[model samples]
Target: MGVRITYLCVILCTSCNGIGIGIDLARYPIDSPTSDEYLQMVNRARRSLAETGCASFPGFLTAEATAEAASEAAAKSPSAFVTDSTHNAWQLPDDDPARPPDDVRNVRMRTRVASTAYDELDEGGALKRLYQYDEFVQFVGAVTSQPRLYRLADPLGACSINVFRPGWHHAWHFDESEFTTTLSLQQAERGGEFEFTPPLRRSQAELAEPAVARILNERSPYRVSCVVADAGGDATAPPVTTAPFAPGTLQIFAGRYSLHHVKRVADDATRERLVAVMCFATEPGKVNSAEVQQMFWGREIDRLHVSPMSMRANRLVRSVFLMLLMISVATVVTAEEAAAEPVPEAKSEAAGEAAAAEASPAAEASPEPELPPLDCKTHELLEKVDTWSIDCVAMWLANLGFPELRTAFTGNKMDGVALKSLTMEKLAEDYGVSEEDQRKKIYYNLKDVLRKDNAAGNTNHYSQMFFWLLPLLGIYKYLTLRYEKQIEKAMKKYKKWQDARNPPAPVEIKTFDDGTNEWTRGLNRDVNLGPKKTKAEKDEEKKAKKIKTPKAE
Candidate 1:
């Protein structure tokens, strides 16, 4: 009953901590401690390492454990010593002849490493527990195929958290150890890619110049791959065969044989990358050399401290050099100013000439046509963007508040002509802009160039108008086109209704009923409506009308 109660209490304690204290066998699988399943996992990892010089296990740490470790590291980050410097891959001393002075292997490294001494960690801390776990050590040894891999005895260099803030990077360098193990706790917002070239340097005397040049020139032929965590019981996500970075994964690499670097993180990154480096050595009590300790940790162990006499000598040399440099700079500046001063004889001659010119009325009457003030707008439009370079387009977009697209354009070599020919679908595919709103923003920003008018103009009016009225015209055209069809339909309906409301008036007709028979007959012939011409003509007409009436009766 007492044993049962002890087990229950242990379970309760683990539950309170939100995760088990030791390696979660479900993920790491040391269940039988010597089971076939565990050995198979180790063998597979070893095989991958041998084949590719690197192996990764995604989700090696439980979610709860990862979170706790990240939190602890963040809390301790304020005390972390930040080192920013440039060094070659071998990290040789300045006097070492083996170190090449002009080799491409000389690269700059920048990073901030936060170290937690083994003695300082809380007894129940996740990192401490993992480091102390017997199964974890055995598992690492088995996977590395090393006869025995022991924990680093150095108090300061054993286990540490490496923090890479925005714009920071790890330079191209080989590791001091044969194998390195790291767990990625977080990732930067963008551009913290991990890249390496295998078999770059075989020995101090032998260096692969072609491969080194390709990587340094950013044109390496080897494909970069990333390990992705498997979720929902699915198989491991296929390695990102073309991308250089991976986050939230566990990796073990034989870095001594591989030349590797972490690409610089972007300046606009929102989060930094956090990684825990668990160092181990084949032999026990092995510590990093004094030079490497100073290079990476910013200080040397007491036993390896430089002699006071040598330090004083170095300081004296630096002070003398600085003093001499300042004096030389001052001398140069004074000489330049004196040389630039106008000569007295030339000044007097120029003054006499000016007075003679002023005395002449013809010369003084009309001043030379004042040159126009520099037109910055025209100059920028014609001289800058008109060059049609990819860099120029990026600058133009950056000025217009679309700086994020600058990288996309530059990467794809999208010059003015290429930008003009790009379609929305193609832009989305090439740039990875999948969001509807962001896609619209990019489309609208480049629409002017994409749909530019190419008709012959007097002075390249398209570029001029694009720089000046593009914003206003874009707004106006969008609004106008949006309502054009609706407005046309409404106008047609109104015209039909107006025509139905007003109709043409009818024609009028009139008739005369009271008419004499003689008059009617005269009307049928040629009626004479005028007064009688003479008295004889009137008497003749009266006689003719009376006879015609008698005959009718």
Candidate 2:
């Protein structure tokens, strides 16, 4: 019983990482194949990927592009070339990652992917080369028949010129397809090994079962590394080996069904590996995830310099003006008559779609900005509390997962100095909390910021307070006096950010009964907040009831 429990325990642990045992399918010691089949396959896959519009690799250029896009690259789902239709291309990372994982590694120096036979596309390009130049395809065919690959065509895939940096190591992960080809464009100074464990390829029994556990728990998993390590089970087994790769060498390997990790480079030399991806799907142009694509939306940013305060203020003013205008018109006139206003059918349909999209499962999972308490006094008091703890608040917001604090409390620049001033002013006040002397002088002496706003564009003291509370209160009451200034500043950054990577979907103007217009983001009225009206107000609203025309409705 003790032995059985030990065996079962190993299986349970392996299951967590998806491994198993006692399986012939996990066979290693594949005496390198001698045929030229894979070379033809590689050439064909390359052509197919090129033929499709959406597939390509990352581009690593300046440090700025590197920082802004690194987190995104790792987060993206693996997308390979398709067979029939085009895909959205702008979402791919601007610069490939410096590491070996597809997110960081350069693919141009390694290999070109080719169309697979299963995709039902005719092979002539890289696929032809995979078989003719080398028996690469033959080696793969001998191992696993009909391996999937990215189809390559001209103009050869978008990123055929990028170079690979040394120490680039692609880690173990399941591939979208069964097989992948890495055509070496360049090698690292040292240590560019491809690693894999064969015991992970079981088909009949779940790889997470007891069978896979014993294999990894054994001591010889590393001995079977066929690419760069000694690939032998016992002392008698032949030492592990790898074929030297050149510009034309086509190296096909089992990826989807195998657990693999590329060895890191030893030196600082940049190694280039330009490999294209190929795959099969239930449909011709199935998408991966909506969140993945949103990353690409704001890539083409406009160069506008706006202070954080101004930006927040602009958004607040615009939102409030629009919101107030709407409420006023509906209050003065009637809801039906306001909606009766004429709108383009295309615009209406687009708005409907945008709303529907926002209401989707994917959208609901995204962050939902909470509206602050409607009472003005409550919002003002909260701002007073938040203003004092700029340091504490900054830390709190950071831990809350808000990415804006990259500079200060949020992204870019945070008005730390301005916060100190506000803290001092509040402390001097006789307000209930600020009146306490034990805390008063402690927060008052810190005025390092007020002396420094010589040309500070974000000199607005309450800018942070504005945004921090807008979602809850719907508007910033204090800054209403600085309306135009705030609006001008925010519009600049919003326009800039929009033009770049995350171009917001174009908005449409929807006019209401009173004298106001609102930007409709094409979202639906599905926010389950319930009938935006009170019963007493509903009765009073009947005196001016307005019926909309069916066409204009």
Candidate 3:
């Protein structure tokens, strides 16, 4: 639902005085900041982004919903404002002839938009402490130090003055860029990830080989616990290790060569990873192939970025198509009477016709929602708690393309913050008592009732004072002494929020065991990662096992 205006804009790249073939773009190494230095860097970055009317912020990439818990929500912001553009990059040609990609390339360019930033962070100015290069070099150097974490991708090659707003699920497919950088001017709630199957590009070739298919389908005998999701804080995934998405911490990745999914992150995980997409590509807008042009208008060789107006119109069509695609994927159901076979209830002769008759319709009440065999729903539940905050997590939900949890309530109570705060004051205006008594009464009433701290399940802003206090107390020298209580409280709130979003379903009470009164229930709780292996997975498995097991009788 973004108010996007797709246009026909050309990538005006500055070719370095006709640099020719045989020259791969030079890469710069991005640096890592010490823990202490990171804190300082974050504060400074925050101030800088805010002044430019930008929306940049920090987030702990983690799965822990409680405050201060490690997370996996790693992202940079300012995506809303960043313009769209195709990254001109390296592409291995197909037999020396490249096949183009499908979809539209809606490009936008962006520049620094943080509030109160240091003046002119360009080539001329260098960090006095690090004592390095000029402003531009220093910035480039900072990002280049860690090629995997901070890729400099600028359209048309050379890093120039630019910025961009990457939309939700910004790039559904892979990119040829070896790595990309972001500054996080504004962060969205969901539907984006810089995921890749590292070294998978090589494995994919092996996987495609006819002989290798059998080996890949076998169920891992040992169900060793693995990371289902990381808010950028958890790095259980192969290669990239660690979770936590700290803003301003530039990210770099070889996207094209990697089988990565820029996941459609749910609202719960959206608030964390806020990156500002910054590119320092040697050749900015040079596409790996003209095939990239085809992505704008699928299978249409004749039509393309011919006009900004036509591109805009085409964007609308694609948007509608995408909407249908999402819905279709979300609601696909199988009418497999075999897989969905129902277990029957038992009836006793002593209870006779009455019991048999009563049990019949009890079984026919409702059918289960036709959903994917995978328990993607459980993952969704875990996501809610994984991305928690004192705030209602509005941004995260929005990012997922889901409506806000409190949308109904907010709409009904629609008052600005000042009005809401003042309402609290008005609620406490009941006294002819002395000034001191009135103030005390209001304070007590407001504290104990509106926002009771000691209450078990109720909460408000007052109760969350501990969240603010613990993180700041002498930097809370002893973790054991403090932070624990506040952390637990925040976790509790997260649990509550999680529960509300995905309430448990009522169970069906039925006859006991075959005859021994051993009650049985089929817990169809979709509580696992996606649907269990579908036909596709089963078919692969069957094909693999066939080689070992006896063939058809």
Candidate 4:
């Protein structure tokens, strides 16, 4: 029994050693450096990174490992989503003219990138195996001098391989992570150098015009070199440096503090740049938002990964609700016009009596042609309301007897689409309509105007679909605004000329007992009261007018 137990113990020990033997740690040291050698190697790397915000070790991976890793990456490259897109560093506000046409903020970047999510790789792949190694993780912690380091908990973003084909590049952007470590598997034949400006911006306020302009328009002196080494051997010897494209090298960078970009690969280059990236977080369970995931990976990994609502999505929702509101308003206007038509005068009693007295039996038997239903002009004037203006919003609120809310809305330049996103709580918070009843009143009033059903509670899927369609409404609004000014000018001129020629009679103005207008009528009311006049009626009217006019004498 003792002999058998000893053999089993030996077998277990050998299996454990075998499990650890795959990662060749000779080129990449896994053991902590000794005290005497520490200052020359570890301390030097730490100091270089602390001062310059970037450090790299050359020939960290053997040629065979690099070739193997490159093979694995190349095999997966065909599945990467290659996308070309344009974006400015700063998001330009809608119709903001304050930003100069030639401002660096206005510059749009064009880049093509092929990137795959880490979850797509095989479990035993080279990249996955290297990242999962405990010794490798400890070695990284020691080199960076970070007290504790954790592999990213995010499944898709933990490890990724980036492939830069000819003419592909990564545009300048601040990284979301603090530290990024990359292993160069293969280098482009030409022009795919990594360039960066260290300590560019610490916060949004620091991303000022002059600072960005200096980096973009002027030659900056703070550009960091990709390759850096510690001085070794003779004291007088300069630390060897190489371009960032050197394969088999490992690079560690403080990407959060540095604004960096990969230079475009040469248009004629035959080789591709393959890089394996491993991202670490100081804390565990750190994950990126769904928008960032979609932007980088072309698709989200999970359906339940909800991100906090973004302004762009809000804009889309508001735009869609505004479109529905426009349709509702149009329906209300048509109904009001139908109701406002004047009642036609019956034939004069005296004329009817005389005609009866002189008429033949056949004339008396003939019936009068049915008077056509009163012709109501289509109400296109509702489009004139400038939803972005405070006065216009005030006019709308005033109709609801909440004129005091105008002060709250003053200086608000949000368009109609944006206003459609307002909730009762937000309305109460902003306008001091703190009373629950008052808030409910305001919400109901707006709801009646904006929606036909006035359904209370959470929005359904149909409502979500409507919000998605709101961008189409935005496009229509843009096109309409472009022509609205010209139309308003023409209408003003026509009104002036008509007033001058007509010299109107005095008329009594009637006021409603209740402060109610056509809009107060619910959208459920019938809007199609009667058919509009056909072209035949217009032609007959012109002929009758000509016949009634006296001849020139």
Candidate 5:
């Protein structure tokens, strides 16, 4: 009975955490990276992605888990934000009226899909669990060949559920992200297919404008492949080939260069098509802009306008709540142990006092402990600072008695480079660091980290000088180049004006008494005839030439 009760408690605790339960570990084995099966799975997905710009796993989630996720999405469907707008293949507004009608930029299509934003997901929901699962993230990174990947920290775009009700669809468009990961929880009764053309752009340096236009204009039937999550047959004309994807399948697609869209569900479809998009980035601190959040999620997250004090207070409340929950769990376990084997009253009292002492807040002590001095020299710290992780920074901040700033720092995904750039103003304005003294504490400590390094005759001093000097040098070079261009232009214009103002003298033809002709050009040359010839003389020469010609004949 005791063992059964203990097992029941474990199950309850596991369910409450909701971390790994959503995934099918036995089938996928993403957590076991060293296993041969894991390597095979990764390699297979990589090959598929390389060939078709997408990869799929048919049973990424268990059937039960898929049902649970579908149910959750269905419940939230009413609250989902619906969007019905016409957009171009680039997903930009048709703001450039000068663009030609045949250009892909001007070719517009309609999208009418509803979305459940990241914030709308429940903390322990199956979709959320899969999205936050470290193993799943790692697997995706492996498939995409990313050495490291971080989940998007955006309040809205991070992980969203996309709903395609009957007669609704997503238009042909390229994704802004390099890669997109999605899991299908449910499929419509009919028609809602995912159709895509292979990557049109060869690389980031060049845009395949003509090919994209072809796809956007519905002229690339041979290149189109219709992927139906529940259907097995592929088609052409509308879609070239059809592929099957069962519900619970996970797909990672390189959609940045591929033109793809979800086909409209049939008007008579019995069920809605539901898919969850899990967003990740190569770099941390990835958040959507306010405009994007508003456009998609129907609201905006004004991080700059938020109050730091209030955020800290909220953090404290959550921390206290979690602490209380832990304490309750511990009390229950302690009671169970006591019932299993009783202790003397005095011993129990003493044990309770020790536990209380350990659990008590440090603020209750006579006075809080002072922050420890840095153990490493400035130069040494500088040498290894580049390798420091976010958690390392958090611990350092905690030691400095500024644990409240951890959320702000982590939310921005600050690294050593970002830390070096942080200023008191940025802290106060962007991060809501309103308290003057707290700002000084953080800003000065960070400055000291570098200042001491410079004072200690480290390479950082020279590097810092070089960095400061670089921009000035660039500005000087740019100004010099610009000035040279202007001077050259001015000189060319002056030469042209001089040439146009002083026209060359016309050539003069002179006839001499000997009948020799001389040509004088401008004022530079003088070809002297023996004597000047009058018009009467010219007539005499003409008569002479005529007489000579008659005599020769």
Candidate 6:
């Protein structure tokens, strides 16, 4: 009995100090820095990062932890904002006046990916806990040889889940941060591999633009490298059938100088490629710029830049406005209700007869009649807008009191197809409707009509609910103001640290030479690490390519 109990304990209890955080401490004793195992792991990571600008530790998390992280991400992924655009390797805008049309910065590539921000993740979840772990931070600092490392303070970009669904791809671009840390939580069924070049830029002052242009123009064997997880559970320079990391792999990469991107996920993939990006900065209170935050998370950095006093003032103004509006609405409603009286049956009949007698023949014989109620039955045509005619859509809009849209639709000859595809930008640019309130009214009402049309028993009572909820908006603003004030106080308390001048010296990065360098020897080779195709499929492709269209004899 004693022997059996010992065996069971040994089998079940595989971790030591990492139990709470779900780290596999037996294999990676990060808490025990003096241990030989810890030293070896750190040295290997440092060496790999120095050589290849990246190092990955597989099995960093236990199996249960990895699954939990993946599950948490999957739940929050529905809210992830889709970023689809075409830009250069530097993530430049489409039209750049600073660079000529033929410049390498003008070169375009398409990327369609989604990201779930740090604020979206559960605060008590495994991924969040791991990111906040002191041991993990210390380990990353040791690996990078930094004297100190601080987690990014950016609310949205501090930690985020990069989700690559089917047909999504991240274009070749460099990160803005000096280094980036990512944990592999899940893998797609096919494609989606990490590929990067070695340090192309030595420093901010000396950017190797020519070398970048070379890779962008010509993906030569000397410039690009493909790292993949091998069967022996290590990241190596060889083709593999899976993604670069198995679940529970932790990768620290110097992505600022090394251009990298995950390959396009295959259209037929059954699963998404999910990676938890854990960010750290050598300096304290570091956060992503407002532009980066907006691009990735579709929001600013918690609006922390606004002063608390100004925020409080704004809140006070909003509260007063809301109170006045609510009082006015209540007064109007009460007056209308008080002005009306229940008519007796005899008096109602008498008034109807009098009203009929007073109506003139010309008024009764008018060609245009009063519009009917814009009810669900009438708006049902909008549910299948493609099948409806322009006249039908115009009549509906006119009944809804949106004559501007009706005019725009008639002028543009915008049929149901165009009406269904109307966007805010279209309304502002193409049409003359510049007022945001009017545009929102037209747009959201159209959506609401469609929604009610499709729903089984939904009615158009949203406007009533909107007025009732107006008071709650003040409450929301007040709560938000209070939260912001607290955050403001906290931020000010750390003002000294945020303004500290002594920053760590930048790490030295070596640039790779194209001609004189031994390109064939190291990890900087363009090896095919994509999904492996069978020999039969390769032959079929070859035959298809060889059999070109025959020209006319």
lDDT of 6 by residue, 1-553 (tens): 0111111111122232467889999988996664579989999999988877888889999999999999999998888988886666665445456765655556567778889987777857888889878778989999989977889888778889999999898877788778899999999988788887777676644445565655654542223321222234432222212225999999998878787878889999989999999889898788887667767777675535533545686676676665555455222211321112224356687888998899999888884653332222343453466555666676667666664466567778876667777876787899878888777777877766555555532333475466457566765766677699887888886886766756567766554554323333343346734444689999998888777856569
lDDT scores for all predictions?
0.60, 0.34, 0.32, 0.62, 0.69, 0.71
Task: Point out where model 5 deviates above 4 Å.
Answer: 1-19, 202-205, 219-243, 289-291, 302-553
Give model 4's TM-score versus the native structure: 0.45
Among these predictions, the greatest lDDT belongs to 6
RMSD (Cα, Å) for all candidates, in order, is: 35.8, 34.2, 35.3, 34.3, 23.1, 36.4
Deviation (Å) of 403 in candidate 5: 34
Show the colliding residue pairs in model 4. Answer: none
Q: Stretches of candidate 6 above 4 Å error? A: 1-17, 92-98, 219-243, 302-553
What digit string (tens of lDDT, one per residue) describes model 5 on residues 1-553? 1221111112223332222566777788886675689999999989988777788888888889999999999999999998887766666654456654645556566779899987778877888777876667888899999987888878678899999999998877777677889888899989788877666665544455555544554642223221212132322222222335569898898878667888879999989999998888888777766655766777776533323544676666655543444344312232321112123256687888987787757646656555343223223334434545565565557657776777777788876666777877798888887887787788767766665554452256577678546545655655566599887889999999988898678877886675555542323245545355689999999999897786645
Model 6 misses residue 17 by how many Å?
5.3
Flag regions of model 1 displaced more than 4 Å.
Answer: 1-19, 31-33, 95-101, 105-123, 199-210, 219-248, 302-553
Candidate 5 has its poorest 10 consecutive residues by lDDT at: 1-10
User: After superposing candidate 3, which stretches have Cα over 4 Å from the reference?
Assistant: 1-173, 189-193, 199-243, 267-274, 282-289, 293-553
Per-model TM-score, in order, reads 0.45, 0.24, 0.23, 0.45, 0.52, 0.49
lDDT of 4 by residue, 287-375 (tens): 65555566667766553342233345556665565555545421111243332433456999999899789988886588666533322
Model 2, residue 470: what's the lDDT? 52
Clashes of 1: 0
Q: Specify the highest-TM-score model's number.
A: 5
Model 6: residue 67 alpha-carbon error in angstroms: 0.2
Instruction: Residues 5-38, candidate 3: write the lDDT tens digits.
Output: 2222233332321012111112211121223454
